[model samples]
Target: MMFLVIAVISTSIISTSLLPNESSHIPFLNDDNFLDWKDQILLTLGCMDLDLALRVDEPPEPTNESFAAKKNAYDKWERSNRLSLMLIKSHISQSIRGSISLSDKVKNYMRAIEKKFVSSDKALASNLMNKLSGMKHNNSKSA
Candidate 1:
């Protein structure tokens, strides 16, 4: 049963990437608006790790559990948690990569979202955003 769930989740992730480029909305997990729900939850967890990193003056750590969807079928998706973590890592990487096009409003909104998962100062999200922006700028300059 557990293996079946992992297989399904894995297949879904691949299919999500391969799905036709239709503009139609599915009322769930569409790519047009923002990251999918799974990505959003993972990003929130990543934000928590980012907060912890700042407080401890260490690098961010992988999530243990909060990213789970808490559904009965999760046993199948359980193994995919590692894959989910990787996806979140990629999202952060892509977010940083795309930060050059991110508007101040978007950045602020994302920072606010990150703040919900963090316990420390609300300012840290801004700080992280600034750092990411700077990094993106530097990368573009070098390219």
Candidate 2:
């Protein structure tokens, strides 16, 4: 009995240390990090098994006559959407979050995020193009 107790305590300690910290975080999204943030968010949600809302379209509302599987799918989807939205929103910068339209669906929320970043990306590309076009060989002054 003493040996059994010691083994149990050791196992519990090891498992506890191996588990992810409750406060561990995905980094907050900012104007410059949308691409990396989007990837990390999806990866984190997938690891947590909470990505159903991102994988499938929302189901029609279940009814008294609905099949058990249908009800189950909807329940899973609803839970995924709710949790995903919370996680995504909580990890975003307040300024960015305030600008994004509210979305009850994870897939749509991601789409909205991508749209926000797309403009930034376009502006960056334009700025780089302008700089490249303005460059001269300067052979007259260079060694």
Candidate 3:
């Protein structure tokens, strides 16, 4: 009885400490909610201290003869990239998950979303303009 309780408590503590708390509750992304989802994803990444993974490109790989400093920098970037990829994959919608290849990197995932949703800032602005231009006011119903 006492042994069982101790085992359970120790397991709980170790498991909780090993995984990030923020990752357990992130919003899932879907096609219809890309704009809102992107904002939330960015916010969550920032909170996890992993925002740099998305903002910056991956560092170049170090050669065998490279200095310790360069190798260390590359290792840090690689870890960040892996973590960011995991987080991004975790939050992606099930419907879209099948489409994103397993080999896709974090930056590729982000760019895929941008390509599917935005393409470019200018393109998004143009799309919005076209929609607004098509709107018709029902002046007969209200002032």
lDDT of each: 0.41, 0.85, 0.74
Superposed Cα deviation of residue 11, candidate 2 (Å): 20
Prediction 2 global C-alpha lDDT: 0.85
Which digits, one per residue and each the tens of the lDDT, describe model 3 over residues 1-143? 99999999998886456446745445788766777777766766666566676777777889999999989878877777788788778888888877655654677778876676654556778989999999998778664
Best by TM-score: 2
* Candidate 2 lDDT, 25-48, residue by residue in tens: 478999888877787788778777
Give the winner by TM-score: 2 or 3: 2
Superposition TM-score, candidate 2 onto the true structure: 0.76
Candidate 1 error regions (>4 Å): 1-75, 94-113, 116-121, 124-143
Q: Kindly report which residue stretches of model 3 are placed more than 4 angstroms away from their true locations once superposed.
A: 1-25, 101-103, 119-143
C-alpha TM-scores of all predictions? 0.23, 0.76, 0.62
